[model samples]
Target: MDWNSFWEGSKDLSTFALAIRAIILYIALIIATRLMGHRQVGILSGHNYLVAAGIVSLAAIRMLNPESSLTSGIVIVFVYAFVNIFLSYLDIKWPKTIDRKPTILMKDGIIHRKNMLDCHVTIDNLLGQLRLKGAHNLSEIDTIVLEPYGKISVIKKPEALPLTRKQMNLPPKMVALPTILIYDGKIDEKNLHAIGLDHEWLMTKLREKGIANPKDIFLAMLESDGTVYISI
Candidate 1:
């Protein structure tokens, strides 16, 4: 294979220079995300998500357009992050300044039609979200809360809840979580060590399952019952 030509790009800049630029921008983006706060990273609230979207768009522009100023991109990122933090501080100090309290969509199995209308939520939408939460009908619900993040939170009535084993005086059995031994053809040595197992034991188990190498197995999980489950 002609590896050099495969990796070759426009003659505008040397590959070494491109690599350096990529590394710097990568680190800068990480710092920018960290400054944006942990909550805003993966699980963003309503307004925070908008800020995150804008930052992502700006970062993309800076990455694709080589003529764009890197310093300007970094400045915009930090500015957005700090502005979001400042607004959050104000929200805490004056709760009503930015965030609205959760809206009640239903009360005691009765749909609050006016409240739902105010929130622009349809009955079908409410029913779909309710079904997602395992509620078959409105009679089984006590309260339906519309969270600010555009998700519905349902509270089932205590009387309508399904019976549990404890209510019938059943004994509890020991439950142990399954540990991942291998994932995506790579053995997770740290997890194996944590579960008091080693490479030799894993290899033996794999051999027993007709897998000569750990890489041949797609996934391997150690169950609580001392069984190694292999998936290829």
Candidate 2:
């Protein structure tokens, strides 16, 4: 057993070279993911999953095979990202053709046996999922839809649903999004500008909070109601 050859491949690329290659590919993948957008990470379709798998395979090949060129691997990663972006555009453009609609597996407290069979879901599996969703029996469920990603979405019967503010005749409250002002000690200028805030305003707020520098704060979030939350 050659320890040296085992630790470092017999090829021209050394262990250190492989480590650097892995790091470069890792950064490239991150950039590619950013280019593909948040949807690629949030809700991945079957084709999107395939694209991710293919990019991973390419990166692995580059790191493992000394004969593999970094340029070729990086090109493949970019190509996969671009192709996924294009496919995503097409999916949005023609959802009916590219994507499958959610199947109604249950309706009106009764299981749609044909849909269950078509989706390859058994009664036991359906019962297990129903239990996981806190439905004691089928009678409590008004509808159950099997999503394209193989997840179950359950809608409870009108009587079984939770009471809302509207039911109590309560006034609706204003809801606002929290904007990230500072993350990892860096100011998000675009977000700050979007909220009609400038650098001077941030500085004044930071100073009021006894924060001498933006780098001193780990995270700072501005709420919709003009409240700033700072964490060091």
lDDT of 1 at 66: 54
lDDT of 2 by residue, 58-171 (tens): 888877786667776788899999999998998899987887788999888788999989989998888898888888778788899998877799999889888888898998
lDDT of each candidate versus the true structure: 0.79, 0.85
Which lDDT tens digits does candidate 1 get at residues 132-196? 88887788889999987778888899998888889989987657999999998999989999978
Candidate with top lDDT is 2
TM-scores, all candidates, are 0.73, 0.68
The regions of model 1 sitting more than 4 angstroms off are 1-27, 64-67, 89-96, 173-176, 183-189, 196-215, 223-227
Off by over 4 Å in 2: 1-10, 173-232
lDDT accuracy of residue 176 in candidate 2: 79
Worst 10 residues of 2 by lDDT: 1-10
Q: Candidate 1 at residue 64, lDDT?
A: 66
Q: At residue 225, what lDDT does model 2 achieve?
A: 82
